[model samples]
Target: MLVFVTGGVRSGKSDFAERRAISLLKENGSNLHYIATNQVYDKEMQERVKRHQQTREKSGANWIVWEQPRKIDELFSHFKKDDVLLLDCVTTLVSNELFSGWETNSEKWKNVVFQFEIEQNLKCLFSQLAGAPWHVVIVSNEVSYDGFASDEGTKVYKRLLGRLHQHIVLLAKEAIMVECGLPCWKKGGIRT
Candidate 1:
């Protein structure tokens, strides 16, 4: 099963998803796994990472935590059918890939090519979720709610994120938009 939870930054989306996944895991045993995507690139990010770690630790020490900034396909291979795989957020994954220069910057291209490629990458990722061995809970940021960003990079980031979320929504067994600590399920009949 794939549950895609999306909301604005600091909208309690991650907390909501984590609690949902953990609740399910409690019934099935302590086989919950958190796949963190945030890369601690600066002091603020490091602190944020520590806080998230503390949250998970307080929840349960039985939960398996894996921090992978890139190569999600490789990461999923470690999961089992009984485990719950919770992805903290996909927005950070995009930023990580972008800053890592996986998307080339050509003076000639209008950034459209890179955007399309990223969308394709996301498509491939969701496609891989079909008949997955584990219960997957994906968390993402909903950036489209905010008005258009001014800078070129911000615009491109927003565009790619929207596209990525759209692609995942199509393949997701359960698609939800979190707001004010509440979830609106757009697909499937998951009662959350």
Candidate 2:
């Protein structure tokens, strides 16, 4: 089963996703896996990562964590049947994929190519997960509400993320948007 969870920053989306994953694990007695996509580039980011790790530890569940900022499709073989995999956030994955070796002076066509590559990579990963028996919970940030940015790069990022969210929701059995620590179901019934 595939689930998509999204919300604004600090909207308790991660906490919700974690609780859902733990619930799935308890029900099936499967191995719990966490695919963290954030790269700590500053002190605040480091603290955020640390806090997430601590939260998982405090849950009293054995979680096998994988720090994968890119090439998520490569991890398909490592997961076993009935395993519960939670990808913390897709925003960081998109940022890492979009900006790794980015050329500020590149032409518009180059940006298109970058977006295509990121989309293809995600598609491949999702395809592999769809065929597997694992219960996948994908978490992402909802940033389109801030309105389209004036900068070209920011615009492209927002557009790409919006497209990705739509695609995932279509594929997911459940799609939820969390606000003020409350989950609003957009697709499928609320599991929790």
Candidate 3:
């Protein structure tokens, strides 16, 4: 099964995802796995990362964590038959790809990424996710709730995330939107 959970910043999305993983593990005896895609480039990020780690620890869940800021497709190789792969924050992963020059769009002024090479990459990634033998949970942030972006780069980034989330929901069995510590199920049931 593929589950997609998304919400605003600090809206209890990650905590909800983590708790769901633990519940799923208890229900099915699946080995829990967590993939963190954010890289700590500053003190604030480092503190956030530390807090996440501490939260996971305090929950007492045995999460086998893997940090992969890019090359997200390669993550499927580590999956197992009875494992539950929880990819926390797809937004960060996409940002890394875009800033590191992996996305491809026709915006001339947008020079960070070129669109000539990402089709096959996205295809392979989706294929891998679909073909995985175990269940998967993906956590992402909702970027379209606020007002219009003031800059071209922010606009492009928001559009990219919106498009990516749409594609992922199509492939997922469940889709949920979290707000203020509550979840609104956009697709599928709560017990899925």
- Which is the leading candidate under lDDT? 2
Better of 1 and 3 by TM-score: 3
Ranking, lDDT, top scorer first: 2, 3, 1
Report, for every candidate in turn, its global Cα lDDT versus the true structure: 0.77, 0.86, 0.79
Cα-lDDT of candidate 2: 0.86
RMSD of every candidate to native, in Å, equals 2.9, 2.2, 3.6
| lDDT score, candidate 1 | 0.77
Question: Could you give candidate 1's per-residue lDDT for residues 65-164 as a string of tens digits?
Answer: 8888877888777777767878878998877765565347533214577667766876787678645766778999988788879887777778777878
- Runs in model 2 lying further than 4 Å from the true structure: 103-110
Q: Which pairs clash (backbone N, Cα, C closer than 3 Å) in model 3?
A: 104-114, 104-115
Query: Pairs clashing in candidate 2?
Result: none
Q: In terms of lDDT, which candidate is stronger, 1 or 3?
A: 3
Candidate 3 lDDT over 1-192, as tens digits, reads: 778899999999998888877877887746899889998889999999999999999998888999998787677667778688888888887777666633454354275445224433554565577567777788999888787999986877787778778888898888888889998889986742
Error of 2 at 1 (Å): 0.4
